[model samples]
Target: MKLSILALASTSVIAISTAAIGQEQDEELRFGLGGAVVTQDEGYKDVGSETQFVPAIAIEYGDFRLLGPYASYTFFKTDSFELAATGMLRLDGYEQADGDIFKGMEDRDMSFDFGLEAEIDTDFGEFGLKYTQDVTNTHEGYEATLSYGLPITVEKGRIVPYIAASYASEDLTNYYYGVKANEATADRTFYQVDSATNFEVGVSSDWFFGQNHMIKADISYTSFDSSIKDSPLVDKSGTFQVLLGYVYVF
Candidate 1:
């Protein structure tokens, strides 16, 4: 199954872009180095929370932005609205050490996704919508998301709290979470997962120091749908993730 990491990373990209668009002036080119610590389920049965430290990199030039495995290009922009094409490298699947339930299951390889997105800046916050398809044929399915972000300024920094809802096609969920008959064991019976909808609420904050240094942090909670929670491969009905890091822009 696609973890919360990718989703949060994508959201961060949008948040940063939203802030940049409001600025009358910005660096022609900027780069940052940081990292994140994520707490997530292993997406399989009998697995506990897994914590991982991942490199965090951000690059931006004009209307283009890149953050880790996610990238986007703002093709059209105005004071209240913006349109962009987005892509992401989905890091999913599991290793043997994850759990015994996955001992005989085939690995779900990472895949590339391409899609279009639009964002609207309103008096209340920024609203976003996106639709993406798996370009690698790994799942032969699509996913869509709707979200809103409200930014609150504190001192020299800003805090953005957002809420999002997502939908995953049956093909996508099954491909990643289902248990095939041939691979099922005595403890894990064959199972199938249908299209599912999930919801997320998160808050991200960034504190600036000078013109080149900043610290960022984010926390989020996700509630899975019955379609995914019912799967024998999944042990948890929800997940919570946290990210904290620093960046240097040049």
Candidate 2:
């Protein structure tokens, strides 16, 4: 009787320990830095789509992801499934070059986004679909993205790379650029925003210089397609940008 009781206790402990280990590996917190060179298409001659710098930080903990102070979302998890809810807000201003269409006017824009996501786990990797709704007057439209993730190489280093792309429509592009009639100044024309899409490919890496201190680099190209091509908001062709920065994770 004594031997049987001891055996039963040992089995239960082993089962509990195994369950805990499995759960630990199911979720992870992945922190990374991203940089990109973004270019906007023509029609914004006044804004002269110049090369601007973009720096960003992202943190993923369990089912929650946070970007700067503007975007936050909660995620759901299944055996190999995922879902999420997201919200975002941002403000931006641009300077125009001389001889540009909207040269005399200042370029200022603000936008807000709220959305949901669904993802599936595949043998190749993780695939996801996302939908976002613009809430602010600066951008009042809907957009979506189909994303995928796959491991390219196994190497010894601090940097790992990946690629992503998104497709947007007229409503989405205009919301970000097409100012309403009342929104535009007296001298400026109510330029209509045309349909456009953006394609982006980039790589990201993490450098562990020391304990509690690290460096990161993200570089990519974003091409914007919009009807405001010859308008006052942007250049005739498009705009490009390159961003570089550093961070400390505690």
Candidate 3:
């Protein structure tokens, strides 16, 4: 479920730009339907690499946008800078059946996060910074991200490569990776973890074909933080994800 959530978030980035490219014109709207395949390490014991197919949709209207479980509205903007409010649904953690060590552990439900974002475009690339908090009380924590994106033009399309680093508050990391006293067993002892940071690097490519038709693809790798890696439920320290889809602009 964590990976699925991340997969959806990744697509949001590629789709959000659809409307902004021509914001100076009349209000624009675009809808896209596609599929994505995500491969990620299970953040639990006894669980191995998992892959799943998911439906993908992108929507944009004026300053409002919806990309999967993420939504945002641009309230201030300029030719080279913009500020927006954002929200997203976070799905992470695991169920008891997910692993032997989690046989009697409680499930971590989905969370709703709200945040603010600032972005700037320069000759070097686009840079962004964002901060979010879990309003749903699921984690009752905050997260911050810093990212940069650079686009390269090809004969028939464009490719954007991006790199980012994120910080998760202690409550967020502990809620997902820590072992509670009640959840501990003879073999699995209770554990607590602190805040941590992670990094990701990815590339997205879009190729235009027949009128208003295009294909998009992206691939990324993420490294987990030590706080998350040292958990009794974790097996791997990183994850790799890939997405491919098609879109049409009106």
lDDT of each: 0.76, 0.49, 0.77
TM-score for every candidate vs. truth? 0.89, 0.61, 0.89
Between prediction 1 and prediction 3, the one with superior lDDT is: 3
Against the true structure, candidate 1 reaches a TM-score of: 0.89
The numbered model that scores best in lDDT is: 3
Runs in model 1 deviating more than 4 A are: 1-27
- Residue range with the least summed lDDT across 10 consecutive positions in model 2: 1-10
lDDT of 3 at 178: 91
Residues 1-250, model 2: lDDT tens digits: 1121222222222222222222343366655443333333223443343343344455555556555533434456777887778775534333344334444544555456688878788787767787777777555667777766653433322443444456666776665466567646765667677766655455544444443344434454455554645444554453333333444343
- In Å, residue 234's CA in model 2 sits off its true spot by 3.0
Q: What is the C-alpha local distance difference test score of candidate 3?
A: 0.77
